[model samples]
Target: MAGPGQRGVGEPPRLLKIVMAGESCVGKTSIVRSYTDPHGAPTSSSYLTTIGIDFKVKPVMFDDIRVKLQIWDTAGQERFHTLSTSYFRGAQGFVLVYDITNLDSFQGITSWMKDIHEKAGDEVDIILLGNKCDKESERVVPKQKGEKLAWEHGIPFFETSAKDNVNIEDAFSVLTKEILEKKSCVLYDFDVVALNESKKRTCCAF
Candidate 1:
């Protein structure tokens, strides 16, 4: 039976795993909380430390299709490197965060990038996020520096404030769209998702 909305209202959404990685206190957890907050409540200013790892399940709708995002929040502590790095497998995308107010956190992104590439597959998409943009007075890492790093690695970049919910949804939406627009690729809970010329024509004809 075909439902009214989209193509398959009853069909299970395609699952996509995403991970947030960065140095400690870079606001990884806060970002997830803001995105998945059901009540639209304000994000707490208090620092929330993830001990080992945490997961949040969010189903985001793209027009008519719903995609479930299993977002893994990794502990930034060096002690958890062995545990956190293990969870990077099978993830389709990564949101690498860096605190704009902390230069050291910015510098630590190199190692995180290496770990993500080594632990996760090389083909996975990644977006660089500079968090805490609301704290302009304490800005240590310039936006140009962040832009340069992203350019060097060939990834999209966004300056976000989780507390204020600035650019959080935009970044995730862009990454999701990129992941979905790939042709003849396999993702979780689905088989052979293709957005090629044939698929596009079929969709347009509908």
Candidate 2:
């Protein structure tokens, strides 16, 4: 593991590979754009569509630790299911998104979570994000229900508004921090053979 201030001149300190999975038009892209370009003006619409999978890298500082987030935005179309599974390889964390105004999107969370756990393992870190929180009048899924679902799955949940920039940063920040903490703990466990070999080598030199 690379510590803070130890990164090479041009290289990043840590790489966090995260994947955003949800139904189409659930504001996954908007959330990514808002975090990556917070100051940019909102556009009326954008026709950009993720073919198999699209990636973006953004550097963020969490409690003095610099982290480079490798975000993968996946296609939600049913026809692309075969292609999307391939992108799940080596994903350390996940952001399961759902539109607040769409009930179907919320219902699909179960299947999506199962797919992620199957591909990345049950130990993989995950965060649930309810997008379009600003649209309260049109919300079909209640906040308490979403929170309950997240609790049942043992994952953190947040209501985020990409349009208003509400809790968007907090959601990602917490998930990233959790990922780093888990990674650090795993790195502390040393192999018995490696430790014994080093001790023997030191004794011979002396």
Q: Give the per-residue lDDT digits (tens) of candidate 2, residues 50-129.
A: 66788889887765566778899898778887677677777888999999899999999999998998888887799999
In candidate 2, residue 146 scores what lDDT? 92
Candidate 1, residue 159: how far the Cα is off, in Å:
0.3
* True-vs-predicted CA distance for residue 146, candidate 1, Å: 0.6
Best by TM-score: 1
Model 1, residue 16: what's the lDDT? 82
Residue range 23-129, candidate 1, lDDT tens digits: 98899999999889925746647757899999999987875667888899999989998899899988889999999999999999999999999998688889999
Superposed Cα deviation of residue 121, candidate 1 (Å)? 2.0
Weakest lDDT window of 10 consecutive positions for candidate 2:
184-193
Question: Model 1 misses residue 139 by how many Å?
Answer: 0.2
